[model samples]
Target: MAKDELGYDRIVERQLRGVAREVLLQVGSKGLPGDHHFYITFRTDYPGVSIGPTLKAQFPKEITIVLQHQFWGLEVTDEAFAVTLSFSGKHERLHVPFDALVSFTDPSVKFGLQFELKNQQVELQPADKPAPGAAKDEAPTALPKKSETKPAETNGGGDAKPATIIALDNFRKKH
Candidate 1:
């Protein structure tokens, strides 16, 4: 492989993200077929994310939401998506930008898509106790440092790995 000069655009990555978002849009517009459901993990503090104060306080860092049943108003746009989910018996709308997404998985068919957040790296860790008065509402924080970010693995025996994930990585030419 030839050396890639500086300022090289990662068009393939962008297209992959687009394809993932398009799939979600289709699921939203239509509906999940058979036992198919989504396990969407995203950065709670991303710029375009909007959750209730309680939810933000609970999941101050990153959160995973399931889209199988008990969801409504799933609207998908070019940049972000919004849906109403029941939390603690209350319906709350969540706005998550596609860039903020970390991973999307459907365990039924073992399908998955992982995305890299722009200018941000997210490292997953155990949740800590909330600080004093941390429950107060606040704006989304800046993207976490790259050092803290880690890619999720789809390892479970040998058959659990999604073929799409491997195929996409192979198609990308590393620089």
Candidate 2:
């Protein structure tokens, strides 16, 4: 077996993360063009992640956020991005680094990207670190209290939730 270059994997990882960041910035700044929304999953414990106490508590390891009609105040930097999203009617800001992202999916187009952590980077922590000023077992306190009134019913049914359908296609055939 041939030995690969030591830094090649790191370089590739960096570039992939950059692509994720760029795509996020574009969608965030311009809004979803046409019928496009993203389901982004990231490691809550990654460095530079700043989330509310309630969110941390609910999603202690990982969380997937939807970028649909309710997110606001998106700002993207070279290394990370910050945005405010409403959860249970309470608005909370989140700061997530590109390195923390594990998956990015556009359900409208059924397009997605999944990443594998490069084990070579031993200095970085896994996706279970507590945010600054947070205790080891601190639960997120930002989640809104449950409302008494039920949400409006759609024409589909009486308050039942809609299902998400995803289609997978394989262009190559193996025998």
All candidates: CA RMSD (Å) = 6.7, 10.5
lDDT of 1 by residue, 1-175 (tens): 6666652346655776787688779988898788777767788989989999988987887877778766789998988899887766667899998888876766666666666668986675444533233222221122223356333445446543533432245555666
By summed lDDT, the worst window of 10 consecutive residues in model 1 runs over 134-143
| TM-score against truth, every candidate | 0.72, 0.65
> Clash pairs of candidate 2?
53-140, 53-141, 54-140, 54-141, 54-142, 57-140
Candidate 2: tens digits of C-alpha lDDT, residues 1-175: 5455565556666776776688878977787788777767776767678999877776775776777677789888988889887765567899997878765666555455555554422221233533335422222222111133122233234444433322111211234
Q: Using alpha carbons, what is the TM-score of model 1?
A: 0.72
In terms of lDDT, model 1 sits at: 0.68
Residue-pair clashes per candidate: 3, 6
Give lDDT per model, in order.
0.68, 0.61
Model 1 pairs in collision: 122-149, 123-148, 123-149
